[model samples]
Target chain A: MQWETVIGLEVHVQLATQSKIFSGSANKFGAEPNTQANVVDLALPGTLPVVNTEALTLAIKFGLAIGAEICTHSVFDRKNYFYPDSPKGYQTTQMDYPIVGPGELEIELANGTKKSIRIHHAHLEEDAGKSLHEAFHGSTGIDLNRAGTPLIEIVSEPDMSGPAEAVAFAKKLHSLVTNIGITDGEMSQGSMRFDVNISIRPVGETTLGTRTETKNLNSFKFMEDAINQEVERQIEVLESGGTIAQETRLYNGDTGLSRPMRSKEEANDYRYFPCPDLLPIIIDKSTIEAIRATLPELPEAKKARFIADYQLSEYDADALSSETKLASYFETCAKTSDDAKLSANWVMGDVSGLLNKNDMHISACPISAENLGALITRIKDGSISGKIAKQVFESMWAGEGDADTIIDAKGLKQNSDEAALESMIDEVIANNPKQVENYRAAEADKRKKMTGFFVGQIMKASKGQANPGLVNKLLAKKLNG
Target chain B: MHSKQLFFTSIGLVKPFELVLEQTMSVTKDDIAKVAKLARIQIDAEQVPEITHGINEILSLVDKMQQADTTHVKPLANPHDATQRLRADEVTAINERDKLMANAPESDSGLFLVPKVIE
Candidate 1:
C-alpha cells in the first residue's frame, strides 16, 4: 500500500530584546542560573507583568515582513500546567488572538519548482525555564533565568508532503527571519527551534491520519532525520495493523531515536482563560505603519537586486544573496575587482570551500574582501596568471601580505613582455631545430599540434612565470617562419 | 443570601441571590475528588459532603449570573477598560540569586532543587 506523508512545522524564534517579555530581567544566554530572574519573572506574590514595547515592535516587524495581517487588538491568556520550570502554575500566551495572522511563504524545491506554504499564525509568549537532570541525586535542579524570554511561535499549515519540502521550508524560514533582524537565528543556542508534526495515510485519502509531534529539534538535519524516522515508524505500525498514538515525542539526536514523553500524557489539559492581570493590547494604525517602514530589504528583493546590479546569473545571484554578510561581501568584492563573474566564482567556489573546511562562517573568513579583490585584479591585469593568483590567495589566507606584496616578494609576475617572450621563443625554436623542421614540413593540422612542444620548452626556460598565451603566440610566429 | 448577592454585584453581575437559591445546581462528591486530585491537593473523605455542598451553592450563583442577557457584551479580560502598560526593553534587574534562593526550601549551586521530576 502506498502512503503519503503530511507535515507541519511550529518554529519558535527567540526575539532579540534586551529584557524579558513581561519583566525587566536581563534576557541573555549562558548566565549563572536564576541570576536573571526577578520578581515578576519569578512570579512572586503581588508582582504583575507589564509587556515590553520592543517585543511587540519586533513581533510586528516580523508580521509586516511576512505580509501577514497584524491583529491590532490582541490579548493574553493563561495556559495552566504543573511543572518545575514554570514558577507560576500557568503560562501566559495568546490563545484567541495573536499578533500575526495567516500568511504564506514560498519555497523553491530541488527541482527548481516553487511551492507556497501557508502560515497559520504567530503569537508572542514567554519561554519556560530550564530543567537540569544531571548533577543531582534523586532531585531535579531548576534554573529560572530563561523563564520569561520573549518568543514568537510561528505555526504553519500541514502543507508539506515529504522531508525534502520540509527542509526547504525550514531553510527558507531561517533565512527570512535572520534577514529581517528580529531573531539572532542561532539554532545552537536555542534561539530558533522546530517542532515537526508528521502523519501518513493512504495515497488517495483526503482525511488526515493520527499525527505525532516531535518537539525541540534545533538543527535542519535533525528535523529531516526525525521526520523520516517518524514517518517510517508510522507506516510500519499501520502496516502491521497497529495504530499511531497522538502524543508528544522527544527526538534523541545522538541516538537518532524518538520516544513518547511520559510526563506529557496527563499534563495535556491546558485549561485556558484570559489573564486578568494584563489587559488587551490595542495597537494603532500609525504604529503598524511605523513598523512597516522599518522593514529591511528581504531575501527575494536582495536576490533580484544582485541579479540586476551585478549582472549575475540566476544561480549565482541566489547563492550570494541568501545571507546578508555574503551579499555585502560579494558586492564589495565585485565593485573593487570590477569583474562580477570572476568575483562570484571565487566567492562561491574557493572561499566557500575554505570556510566549510575550517568550520567557520563567512564573517570569520581570514581573506578580507579587499585583499581578495586585489588578487582578482592582479589576475585580470596580467600581473599574475590565474593559476598563480591561487597561490597568492593562499598566502593572504595565511596572514601573509596582500597580492601585490606577495607577487613582488616571490617574483611570480607573468612574463607578458613581447620582447622578452620572443627571445625565449626564439631560443626554444633554435634548441628544438628538429621539431621546428618537422612542424614546417608537416600539414597544417599536424603542424598545429606540434606547436605544444615549442611552447613547453619556452615555459620551462622561463621557470613557469612565462605567460602561456604570449608563448603560444610567439612560438607560432617563430616556428612557422 | 445578602453576601452572595453583594458578591455578584461587586463583579458587575446584576443577578439576584434569591433566583440562584431557587435553581437546582449540584456538585457530586466524585467531581470534588477529581478536582482535588487535579490540583494536587489532599482532602479527607469525611469533608467531601461539606465541600460538595459549598461548591454547589457557588455553582448556583454562577448559573444565575449566566442567565443574564449578555449578547452584546464583549468578554471582559480585565475589570477596568484600560490597555496594558508597556515597559521599555532595558535590563534593570541585577543578580539577586543569593537573596532569592533564601526563599527556596532546598537549593544548591544557585539552583532550586525539587524531588526528582524526570521525564
Candidate 2:
C-alpha cells in the first residue's frame, strides 16, 4: 500500500530587537556566555519584566503581513518547565490566545504548482539559552546570552503532503520574513528555525497517524532530510506490525538518523498559567494599518512586478525575486543594460552558477552586477561574442578590472569587420579543399552539418575574437557556392 | 472554564463570581505534589499529608476575607494605565560573564556547567 506523509512546521523567528523581550540585555548573537543576561533575564527576585516596544511592533508587523487577525488583547502566560538553559522556572509565552490568528501562506512547489498552507496562529515568546555538551568533562554547559531573547513562533496546520512541499513552505516563509525586514533570516545562526512534525499513513486514510516532531532543523537541506527520514521510519514501523509513538526526535545529520531523546526526562507536561505581572496589550485597527503601511514589497508582490515591468518569464521572475538582495541585484543589472533578457540570462546563468560553485552568496560575489550588466551590453552591441564575453566576465570576477578594461587588456574585442572575417573564411576554405568538395557534392542538409568545420577553423584563426554572427554569415556564403 | 484569564484587561470587572470561585478553591495532595514537581522543589514523603493539611487550614483562613461583599469596588489592572513604564528599546548591557558566572556551582569555558541533562 502507498503511504502519504503529513507534515506541519513550527517556525521560530528571533525578532530583530535591540534588547531582550523583557529585559535591557543586548539581544545579539555570539556574545560571551552569560554576559547579555541582566537581572530581569536572570529572574532575580524583585526584578519584573517590561515588554520591549520593538518586539511588540515587530510582532504586529508580521501579523499584518500575513493578513491575520491581530488580537487586540493578548496575555503572556508562564510555560513552566525545568532546564539549565531556562534560568527561570517558567518561560513567558502566549497560550490559547496568540497575537496572530488564522492566516494562510501560498507556497509554490517544485512543479510550479501553488498550494495554500493554513496557519493556525502565531505568538510572541522568549527564547531559552544554549546548552553546550562537549566541553565540561561530562557536564553540560549553559550559555544564557540567548535567554529572554524575543521570538515569534508561527504554527501551521498539517496541510503538507510530503517533504518537498514542506521545504517549499519553509522557503516561502523565510523569504516573506526577510523581505519585510522583520528578521535577518539567517538559518545558520538559528535566526529562523524549524520544527517539523512528520507522520505517514496508508493512502486513502482520513485519520492521521502518530507523529514524531523533529526539532531545531535550521538548514533547508537538513529539514528536508529529517522529514524524509522520519516518514520512512514511521512507514517501516507500520509495515512491520509496530505502532508509532508520539515523541520528540532529534535528527542527527552526521549519522543520517533520527532518535528519541532519553526517555527518563521525556516529561513534557507544561503547566500554563497567566502571568500576573504584566497586563495584556490591546492593539487597535489603526495600529495594524500603520504597520501595514510600513511593509515593503513582499516576495510575491515583487515577483509579479518583475514579470510585468521587465516582461520576464514567470520562472525567471520567481527565481530572481525570491530573495530581496538577489531581486535588487537583478533589477540593477536589468536597468543598466538594453537587453533585459540577456541581463537576466547572465545573472541567472553564469553569475549564480559561479557563486554556487565557490559556495558564496550573491551579496559576497566579487563581480558587481553593474559590471556584468556592462559586459552584457558589449555582447549586445556586437563588441564581443558570447563565448569571449565569458572570458572577460571570468577575468572581471577574479578582480582584474571592469568589462571594457579587461577586454582591452586581453584584446578580446570581437572583429566584427566584414573584411577581416571574409579573409579568415577564405583562409579556412583554402586549407580544407577536400572537405569543401565533399560539402558541394553532398545533399542540402549534409552541407549544413559541414559548416561547423569551416566555422571552427575561422574562429581559431581569429583567436576566438571573430564575431560569431559575422563568421556564420561569411561561412554560409562561401560554402553554398 | 472561565477565560477571564485570557483577558489581562477587562478583568475583575464582570462580577464577584470569579472571586468567589477562587476563594472556594482548595488543593489536594495530588495538586500539591504536582505543583511542587513543576517548581522543581523536593519535600519529604512523610510531610505530604502535613503540608496538605496546612494548606487547607491556610486556605480556610483566607476564605474569611471573601465573606465581605465589596460590590462597590471598581476593578483595576494596575494603579496606572495599561501600558507600564516605557523605555526605548536599546542595548545597554555590558559583558559581565565573569562576574555573573562567579555564582555558578561549576563553570567551564565561560559556560555554566551542570549535571548532564538528558534532553
Candidate 3:
C-alpha cells in the first residue's frame, strides 16, 4: 500500500538578547557551568522574574516580519515537568495565547515551485539548562547558564509531505530568522533547534494517522534524515501488521537511527497553568508599529530587489539574497566590479566553494568582498584573463595583496596587446605548418575546431599570459589568410 | 468563579450573573494518589480517603463560586490586574556560582551534581 508522509516542524529560535528573558543574568553560550545563572534563573526562594524588554521587542519584530498578528496581550504559563535542567520544575512558556498568531512562509522547492507553509503560532518561552552526563561518575552535572534564555518557538501546520519540503521550510525559516537579526542562527551552537512531527497514512486516506515526534534535531540535514528514517519505520510497522506508536523519539545523527524515548513516553502529561508570578504581557499599538518600522529588509523583499535592481536571474537572486550578509557581500562586489552577473557567478561558485571546503560561514570568509570585486574588475578589463584571475584569487585568499599587486608581482597579466598576440599567433602558425595547411584545407566547422591547437601552443609559449580572445581572432585571421 | 468575580469587582469591573454550577466535580482516592505522585509528594494509602474528602469539599466550595457568570469577564492571568513590567536587556548578574554552590549538596567543576539521570 502506498503511504504519504505528513510532517510538521516546531522550531525553537533562541533570541539574541543581552540578558536572560526573565532575569538580568547573562544569556551567553559556553560560559562556565553555572556562573551565568542568577537567583532568578536558579529559581531561588523569594526571587521574582522581570521580563526583558529586548526579548519582547525581538519577538514582536519577528512577528511583524512574518506578517503574523502580534498578540496585544499574551500570558506566560508554567509547563510542569520534573527535570534537572529546569530549576523551576516547570518551564515558563506561552500555552494558549502566544505572541504571534497564524502566519505563512513561502518556500521555494527545488523544482522552482513555491509552496506556503502555514505557521500555527509562535510563542515566547524560557529555555532549559544543560545536563551533562559525561565526565561525571554515576551522576549528571547540571549547568544553568542557558536557563532563562529567551526563545520563540514557531509551530508549523502539518502541511509538508516529505523530507525535501521539510528541509526547504527549515532552511527558509532559518534564513528568515537570521536575516531579521532575531537569532544568531548558529545551528552548531544550538541557537536554533527543530522538533519534527512525522506520521504516515495510506496515500488516499483523508484522516490523519498517529504521529511520532523526533525531538531536538539541530541541523537541517539531521531533520531531513530523521524524517526519512521515521517515515520509513512507520511504513514498515504499518505494513507488517503493527500499529505506529504515538511517542517521542530521539534521532542519533551519528548512528542514523531513531529510538523511542521511554522516559518521555511514560510522562506525557505537562500540566500547564497560567503563571501567577508574572502578569500578562500587554503590547501597545505604538510599540508594535515601532518594531514593525525597525524590521529589516526581509529575505523575500531583498530577493525581489536583487532581481529588479541588480538584474540577477531568479535563481541567482534567491541564492544571493537568502542571507543578509551574503546579499550585502554580493552587492558590494557587484557594485565595485561593475558587473552583477559575473559577481553573482563568482560569489555563488568559487567563493561559496571555498567557504564550504574550509567549513566556514560566509561571515568568516577570509577574502573581503571588495578585494574579490577588484579581482573580477581586473578580468572585466583586459588586465588579466579569467584563468589568471582564479590564480590571483587563490593568492588573495592566501593573504596576499590585492589583484593589481599580485598580477604585477607574479607577471600573470593577460598579454592582450594586439602586436604581442599577433606575433605569438604567427609563431604558432609557422611552427604548426602541417596543422595550418590542414586547417586551410578543412571545412569551416573542422577548421574552427583546429584553432585550439594553435591557441594552446601560443599560450604555452607566452607562459599562459597570452589573451585567448585576442589570440583566437588573430589566429583565425592569420591562418585563413 | 465567585472569588474571580469578587476579585474583578474589587478591580472596578462588575460581572453579569447567570448562575449555573456543576456539582459533579469531585476527587477520588485514586485521583488524589495520582496528584500526589505528580507533585512528588509522599502520601500514605490510609490518608488518601481523608485527603480526597478534603479536596472534594474545597472543590464544592469552588463549584458554588462557579455559579457567578463571568462570560463577559476576561480571564484574569494575575490578581493584581497589572501588566508585566519590562526590564532593560542588561546583564547585571555576577558570577555567584561559588557563593550559590555553597547551598548545593554536591557540586563539582562549577556544575551541580545530581543523581545520575540517563535518558
Q: Can you give the TM-score per candidate against the true fold?
A: 0.90, 0.88, 0.94
Best by DockQ: 3
**Number of the top candidate by TM-score?**
3
State the lDDT of candidate 3 residue by residue for A1-481, as single tens digits: 9999999999999999999999999988988789999999999999998999999999988888878999999988878778888988789999888999999999888787899999999999999999999989999999999999999999999999999999999999999999999999999999999999999999999999999999999988999889988888998999999998789999998888899998644566666667778898999999999888898899999999999998999889999999999999999999999999999999999999999999988889888999999999999898888888889999988988888899999999889889988877777777778997888889998887788888889989998898888888888788878
lDDT of 1 by residue, A52-79 (tens): 9999999998888888999999988777
DockQ of each: 0.45, 0.35, 0.46
The clash number for model 3 is 0
Question: Using TM-score as the measure, what is the rank order of every candidate, best first?
Answer: 3, 1, 2
Off by more than 4 A, model 3: A264-266, B1-23
DockQ agreement of candidate 3 with the native complex: 0.46
Best by lDDT: 3
The 10-residue segment of model 3 chain A with minimum total lDDT is A263-272
Please give the TM-score that candidate 3 achieves against the real structure: 0.94
Residue pairs with backbone atoms closer than 3 Å in model 2 (clashes): none
Interface RMSD of each: 4.1, 4.7, 5.6
